[model samples]
Target: MTTDSLDLFADQPPTPPAPPDDAGAEAGDDGTLALDRYAERAYLAYAMSVVKSRALPQVEDGLKPVQRRILYAMSEMRLSSSAKHVKSARVVGDVIGKYHPHGDSSVYDAMVRVAQDFSLRYPLVDGQGNFGSRDGDSAAAMRYTECRLTPIAELLLAEIDRGTVDFIPNYDGAFEEPQLMPARLPFVLLNGASGIAVGMATEIPPHNMREVAEATCHLIRHPDAGLDDILAMLPAPDFPGGGQLISSPEAIRDAYASGRGSLRLRARWRIEELARAQWRVIVEELPHGV
Candidate 1:
């Protein structure tokens, strides 16, 4: 057997077989009912593993592993500031091989989503060739698409080499991993998040960068300001795709006061006239599931 397999077996302890189908098992000495504690413990361990490793976002970094890998892969490709674009296939291969260690299709899908301006209020990717659209169209094949990082991404990744964050050994100890991201902006609010876990979940809405920043500054200056004061600075969520926040004025006030609530959003459309034709296009829309 391989060394790794031997090690795995060595770490495991043998379990006792259960009583035969017709046999009545005796209770433990302490009068406790017989139970498969080992199995229960194993199941609980697996659940906690999934929750810690997948569902919950790391508050320090404001990103999951896949998201971090995508940004780093873009930086490694030298696609930050240069006009030269790399094929999406190249990016996918790099991320899968060097960082994400996941299927190429999923990595490519995330890449396209990050590039779509309509999906993100501030897209972190600058893509060429069809990267998909807000109407739920699939992006072109990796070979047909080209990509690079946007200026905002550049700012986020720049701190990686500056020793501002921590790095540790990866799962296999064959590579290093970033413990957290030194994000210049509050990206959690900028892009928002939605994730599910055992007995828990989170749903956050995207907000305008300018408005959020202004509100943050105001809060800093007047630490004791009430919810109304903060709401005065940030009237409502301003989406990049130019949409109206449809919640009642009172609803917004309540949300800010309670620190939680849902907001309604609607798309904004505009009509354009050409020399021989007229066209209607949606200029803006609220973030999905707002």
Candidate 2:
């Protein structure tokens, strides 16, 4: 015999097995399954939960679950535009202890971001302390900060008092929170959103309220308007911070049409002529979310 014949299977296991009988088929019918199936189902559940309830913002209000909860908690405290700013710690505490149940730091961070003028195109919270910096500095401790809702924020919460949206019990069932804000406008497109979830991601740029309104009005008037026509009305993003969009109008239109592509933006600056022939370049507006 050759040396290959001495192999374990070669020595005694050359016979072909018969096809699976009825009993063999029945064996797989039990609740047990391949390990991958169990893992797949478990992972799907987690992904869906993250995508729907945590990561992505709701299209109707343009707010993520945490953001919505923060706003709801602030509204409950009557932190309206006309009201006094409450301590950031109190808001974080209430959010963690009630609706969010995540952690104080995260909740405070979200609130701080909402209050930051350099962050949100339309700031929701009006802060009264060292919230943060544009150069990537961290905000002060929550205890040192105070905040209340801005006038624009009131638009999202106005109808809540009138029962425009239904309230569901908080995490512990001790309180109630709105299912979704009854937004008077398309805040999602107005503010924009970016998030990464399991198997998916989204990054939408902010737009000027007036441009958005004009496009929206056109759509309302001519319901059959195509994406190109809409682009004609609002050619490119109008950052509130006022930057130059380097991307051509055609590129912007393509992005909007295909629901993908990047819009290049450059900060706008102006040269100031001073006395004695001295000149200084001053940055006027930065591309928001850059």
Candidate 3:
């Protein structure tokens, strides 16, 4: 009899196993992880990092990580209002090298914003060169600009070493920085803050220092004071641009009570007659965000 016929199919290798549902992910020692679960965890970690380390301003100091770092770096260099101003590049270098460990442009941009009068109700940095303009002009390069801390900034840093606040290690653990500046007053209310983080945001408009102080005093005297009583001392936001708020009193009251509301703002402008029959408009002040 003839030998059993060879089967070509029998010699063929078995089909390779199918890939996991998450084709992009590689197998780990633990087990296969769903793509969605991995993404969710990554997103959550990134969001928390931004909220805590970069985006939001601390309620205690009313300064974001970058801003606080710049101020602290300046203070360490003794760049006070009365001190001789130094090249902004120098400050930026120190900040990146010692504390912030970020891009030079970002650090310089934050410094410029702190010096811009139009950007803050009370500017915290004293810039000697073109910092910026309300018309959207950018500041000069760091090498060309010089800066120092404003007198008011001293209010935030003066007691830093008097045991008023806690200090923590910097990024490389080579230096120490304050956890939060010991501001005498609520700088958050005075300068106002606007930042959008991963899931939450803030849009606090600046208020008059006198009004805030009076309201604070009222609260201290009458701990149970009603919102109406507080409002009497601090009626509304006092923007640096000096625009008129057209929102009704009722609307303002409701906003404060509910912690959510919008205010209508009107720019202050006037007409100036030109040489020709045409007249030009001169804007005296702009709305808060403008």
Candidate 4:
């Protein structure tokens, strides 16, 4: 009975070969890494990519990678203010082919948002067709649209050729791209930013240009001045699509100081009196990101 059972076992397949050793472990006997360590490294890499390459705008330039790439590609095409608008599809194609190396829709969406007046305090692109609406309507397809850089955008790219900023290799390394725009103004604070990265997110509200300039000059003059001095000049955020700030001045100061706080924004409306007894509330502006 033992011999028959042993023969049956021999006919069965030999235990599958032990799983191959990991590349690092096989390449160097002493280089073996635990599974947890490997997972930590991988996750850290993904988080860095999301934070640096995809989500956050460079504070200096106020432009995300995709937004910057689209503008750069358009500049390459000589789609400046004076130049006639070109099919948005052409710009999207150039971006995806040359630098971005992503889906066409993503590039186009980024471009569209840059052109939106209600979105940016100062729009970067001048689009010739239905870019979108504040009512939450989607823009027309890229093929049906045309665009060129606005005058303000030219300011960002003005000294790009003169090497005002560093250059980095593109996704495929076939070409190079700017690390950030050579912005003449502090567009980062001017335009504001909102992004969600791996561990951190940002939500900066747009500000009035005049107030921003004054505050900047004030800082230049009084480097040791406290937040009150800045707040005296800047007061509170002034969004492009004007809205009323219900947050008190003290609360605003606290938010700016602590790097975390929410602003209470109310829609700006006006009363249009049709008659002595009848009136209508006309909403002139909506809260940011409404």
Best by lDDT: 3
lDDT (tens digit, per residue) of candidate 1 on 36-106: 75455555565454445555456554565667778887776788756588898998998877776657876
- Which sequence of candidate numbers ranks them by TM-score, best first? 4, 2, 3, 1
What would the per-residue lDDT of candidate 2 be over residues 1-290, giving only the tens digit for each residue?
00111112111122232332332343356734565655665566656666677767888899988899999888888888899888999989988888987757668878888888877789899999999888788899988889999999988888787879888998789988888999988888888877766666777777788888889899899999998787777777665567788988778877887778887888888999999999999997787665
lDDT of 4 by residue, 1-69 (tens): 000111110112222333333536533457666767566666656566666777778888889988999
Candidate that would win on TM-score: 4
Candidate 4: how many backbone clashes? Answer: 0
Give the poorly placed runs of model 2, Cα more than 4 Å off. 1-27, 274-278
Question: What lDDT is obtained when candidate 3 is compared to the true structure?
Answer: 0.83
Which ten contiguous residues of candidate 1 have the minimum total lDDT?
1-10
Q: Rank the models by lDDT, top first.
A: 3, 4, 2, 1
lDDT, residue 10, model 3: 15
Worst 10 residues of 3 by lDDT: 1-10
Superior candidate under TM-score, 1 versus 2: 2
For model 4, the stretches where C-alpha displacement exceeds 4 angstroms are: 1-30
Give the local distance difference test score of model 2. Answer: 0.78
Error of 1 at 145 (Å): 1.0
Question: What's the number of clashes in each of the models?
Answer: 1, 0, 0, 0
- lDDT (Cα atoms) of all candidates against the true structure: 0.69, 0.78, 0.83, 0.82
